[model samples]
Target: MTSTPTTRNPPTSTASSLLSVEGLRVAFPGRRGAPAARAVDGVDLDIGRGEIVALVGESGCGKTTLARCLLGLVPPTAGRVTFDGAPLPRSARALKAYRRRAQLVLQDPSGSLNPRHTVYDVVAEGLRIHGHAGDERTAVAEALSRAGLRPPERFFLRYPHELSGGQRQRVVIAGALVLEPELLVADEPVASLDASVRGEILALLLRLRTELGLSALVVTHDLGLAWNIADRVAVMYLGRIVETGAVEQVLTAPRHPYTQALLSVLPEAPGAPVVLSGEPPDPSHVTAGCRFHVRCQILAGGEAERAGVADACRHRELEILRGGDAAQVACHWARAEQPAAGTGDAAVGRRPN
Candidate 1:
């Protein structure tokens, strides 16, 4: 990899984008003498108003860190994140107001909901924090109703231990909705729910978008969920986005080796499931060239070698894959005007560790 800080080009916010991340990076100081861990490195993403964007990646791929940075919960080491044409503020008062407009719905309803708090109290906490002066009861009830808890008053006094998994999730959603935020950042929103409950929560998310014009950035490892709900999908690996495009285009016919390997493992996927050899390299010690090169099926198949780009695959640094309707892949061979030698829909298998 090479360094050219002056040449770093971040994505500029588009008019339709409600939230934008421009060349963002977050590096954490390493333990002991280890190198600093690059949790989120050079990620560019855009979420349009009223649109749903899925940030899909394996565990430890830094999707959660990226989401945290977007919500201003963590500071970035480089670049910037903007919301509604304005950069995220640093002042406590301004950040508090920013949080009011951009809420987070966590993955586990049980972990998120306070066990002792009544549904009404849980949802009203945000309003109280923001010093909302409007009718508190009306606001809480409206949020509950919107989150699909009909006859909101019935559940108002019920505690978290009294609600079903789906109901608890609804309560969590209502807490975020109580303030009527413009955007929601949901990290692994349905990971803990049963299959039946997962669909319902996903439906609730879709319904919210349709009815309230709420934009969202959903972080998950499930590609199937991305196809079902997101307008677009961004595939992240080891602190970087390797592929991104409209969900249909990227999921149905992927180009990047990493993206192809991921989609091929879906139960309904057409080809043999690709079992990657091992976990991704440690973020603190990222290898050069493509972040995914070591695990890339295409590279293992000798396609990069045949295409005369293997050295680049091992030594060159790749730029961030920008988000758009048309599919984009960050790869030395795949990005060449000509496709890599003997390229196919997918090239996958076990590689030597």
Candidate 2:
């Protein structure tokens, strides 16, 4: 296999980043006395106010774990998360306030909603939780309307079982929005819906962001979804962020090896598919060099060059793993070559063996 790089225009930044995560790491105790498993090694992110950023990675890459850590649902082993220049709370009260400020719309809408409660009660739940009982009815109406459940009165008394898949998902969104949060953490929110409903939910989320001034941290493994909705994209590998850049830049002109391989499998056109030769390696092993070096297509000259590239690769990888950072790469030869725009030859060192 050969590595290739393409150059594409970056997204226009309309405003400043609202949420910033620096050197975030999360670890869980291993079985017995063994070392802890580092779920999120070192991740840095920046989500501009009113902008949507997607965390793209396969299962076990720590996208969900990172989300849980950011929300304070699971305490981080290290690093910090900040919102609008204010540090997140570590205590329950502060955490509750943080949760109010940043709500989550889970993937499974059917499972998330209470079957016994009507859509009205479900949307109004957050209002009551936050002590907004005085105007609960009006708030529910507005939220429901915003989520595209028009004629809110009609859907008000309808139970979860009575609503369609799309309707149920909208209610879940309305439930989260009733709190008037600044950030929305959506974990694969459209993954469980039908193809048609997926587009509807995505459009709703985008519309909500525009109408309500809400920023988002979307977590999904689908590159197509990220390409469609996210302003910027972050690719994770083995519990650490491998690459992050403007969605256009990373999607069309990915700088990291893993990012290239990911785009490879995704359809470049209607019938194209870039298939992988083997499954990803286990994340538990904790390799010494670049976490992706094992599967990377960028080859070094000899054992010494390979080892040197691996070490240099590790250093450069972490430096440019977040948006707004310089676009530096890890591989020795590839980095030195700095592939010309729109050419695979510049990145592949001669050709694949």
Candidate 3:
């Protein structure tokens, strides 16, 4: 997205991430017979230095809330978010510093940019807030130019309403970049844009990542989009991470049932889509054994089919392995006969657990 190219800068060591999370949990209040809603229940994730990790799941699965917790915008009832080996504190001073190092690009571009402010003011706000004393003229111009609003001078004085949707969105990106964050948490930044513009923006985010040497956590429900940009993919289910691995591995050979269902529906490689039946179970009313058991096609038969086994046994013999390892299905029989790593065949060809 740039003509006069600039060399990418490596991230400062002080801003790098270490083991980022462990068993994160968040809950809302409940009453009567209803239990408190646990939006994020025991989620474990880590986004290392210079990594692009995508967190994909259905709506209301706590992806956004998890992002909020990561940024310290919301307090976590359980778990910890660490940066560069240090735990993040809920204190205002710690949070302010965290805000500078890690920034969030909201879902709605239009809602993010101020209607009253000129483009220059919108991009300049971060610098002003952070007590930056550099020449405002040069910083604003550079940020806008880097975002591809070239000869940035022409666009500086225009209001948000004057620019096209794409341009306005870029303005929001420029504003975020001006602060020069080490990590960016983009919460479905392209979900609201036109189909044509979506790719353009995705390209922009990727180019910025390469040129700026920035690490990112891209949150979206679209598996296709995650495949396109993320170096690694982490699939979330009912607020927990069900699968994670390199983009090629997780997308092509999913280990988790939820992950399998998601990839099966993708329009990848221009094939007919794999249609799925039933919606995700309600969080409050999630079933015993596994949250997805009700809709899962891997249920075991009752006493007549298998006499010593429980009437309903959860296939829990699977284990997480590195990408290119055997097809690590979360089903008991599949794990018992786990295939050799990189076998390119199913551990147990799609069958009932």
Give me the candidate number with maximum TM-score. 1
Q: Rate the local accuracy (lDDT) of all candidates.
A: 0.83, 0.74, 0.71
Error of 2 at 75 (Å): 0.6
- Pairs with steric clashes in candidate 1: none
Candidate number achieving the greatest lDDT relative to the actual structure = 1
Residue 173 Cα positional deviation in candidate 1, in Å, after optimal superposition: 0.4
Candidates in order, TM-scores: namely 0.91, 0.85, 0.82
Task: Indicate whether candidate 2 or candidate 3 has the larger lDDT.
Answer: 2
- Whichever of 1 and 3 has more TM-score, that candidate is 1
Candidate 1 RMSD to the real structure: 8.1
| TM-score (C-alpha, index-matched) for candidate 2 | 0.85
Q: Order of candidates by lDDT, top first?
A: 1, 2, 3
When sorted by TM-score, best at the front, the candidate numbers are 1, 2, 3
Judging by TM-score, tell me the better candidate of 2 and 3: 2
Give the Cα-based TM-score of candidate 1 against the true structure.
0.91
Model 2 CA lDDT for position 227 = 82
Please, what are the lDDT tens digits per residue for candidate 1 over residues 80-137? 7889989999888899999999999999999998898999999999999999999999
lDDT of 2 by residue, 202-254 (tens): 87888887888888889999888888787778788888776665677677777
